[model samples]
Target: MPTHHEDELDYTPTPHNVTRARTRTAHLAAAWGHPALAPDVALVTSELTTNAILHGSLRGRLIRVRLAVVDTTLRLEVSDPRAERVPHPREASPAEQFGRGLALVGALCDDWGHGPRDGVGKTVWAEWKLPG
Candidate 1:
């Protein structure tokens, strides 16, 4: 089937960009008639963006957020300038405030993975099946 929706954004690698990405994801989801998916989308976006900013690219580079719906699956992709540092879900302590993002993404998403982008970076993606 043809893609039902697609959008993307490129932002500077600054801390504020995390919030910007999340907000944009919410807007896109809502506009696509999936407003209820916004909260989880925002959460996933925040985590991936923050990780990209913190671990992937922090200088002289741009991070990208791409949203797409193919068939009935919603896919979110965050690309950063470091292909070598792929993210993985790990166990976090109860009191830890860090390193739970991938875990949350794994729990909330139907599937997620990372792959090399065309250029120097990697795109981390998460997918969810939308209700019919």
Candidate 2:
């Protein structure tokens, strides 16, 4: 049986760091021999990190970007420092500029959810099942 493989990185909540997280996720997916999952993974990273920066970020706190592979499933987790700002998918108006990140995450991943961390903040995660 294949064992679970995972890695994580912490980043200050910033727009530039979101890009860095996305790039790192893409690179990791490829290095793990799942290049096909890179694009979607990158997109999910972008959405999650951006949401963190906008809603969950706090002073002196950092966001965590985590990637994991268990069996054929690939997981991406972004943990930010605001437990109060929970995320949910909602309809975005045509005139609105935001409010669709989770929707996009849902479209790209097989499963996604969020939960509070041990002390403060919360973790938003998405997972995709690799093609067998």
Candidate 3:
């Protein structure tokens, strides 16, 4: 039987940190014998990391990204230093320049939600079903 494991990586919210997070997720997915799920997971991580940097105020604060593989699901959680603002799916107009990240996340992910992390910031999480 294969054992399930959880992998976590924490980093500061910078413009270049997104790539690092994606790379870490990919490696972990491969290690867990789920190479096919890497792209989707990486994309989802990219969206969350981007949102954390863009909307969550990327000061000197750090962003934490966690990846876990359990059974047939892969979970991605990104935490940043802002708990005041919550994420919601909003209707985007043709002329709108923003507010499509969560929509894309919803379409790609099996399910997702946001909530406070401990006493600090908020964590945005999504899960992807692995293909057999």
Q: Over 4 Å off in model 1, which ranges?
A: none
* lDDT by residue for model 1 (19-130), tens: 9999999899989988888899999999899999999995888999999999999999999999999997889899987878898998878899999987789999999899
Question: Which run of 10 residues does model 3 get worst, by summed lDDT?
Answer: 1-10
Q: What are the lDDT scores of the predictions, listed in order? A: 0.91, 0.91, 0.85
How far residue 128's Cα lies from its native spot in candidate 2, in Å, is: 0.7
Models, CA RMSD each: 1.2, 1.5, 2.4
Cα TM-score of candidate 2: 0.93
**Reference-based lDDT, residue 54, model 1:** 90
Residues 1-132, model 2: lDDT tens digits: 574788899999878999999999999999999988899999999999999999999988999999999888998999988999999789999999988888999999999999987678899999998877
The collision pairs in model 2 are none
Deviation of model 1 at 70, angstroms: 1.4
Clashes of 1: 0
**Residue 111 displacement (Å), model 1:** 0.9
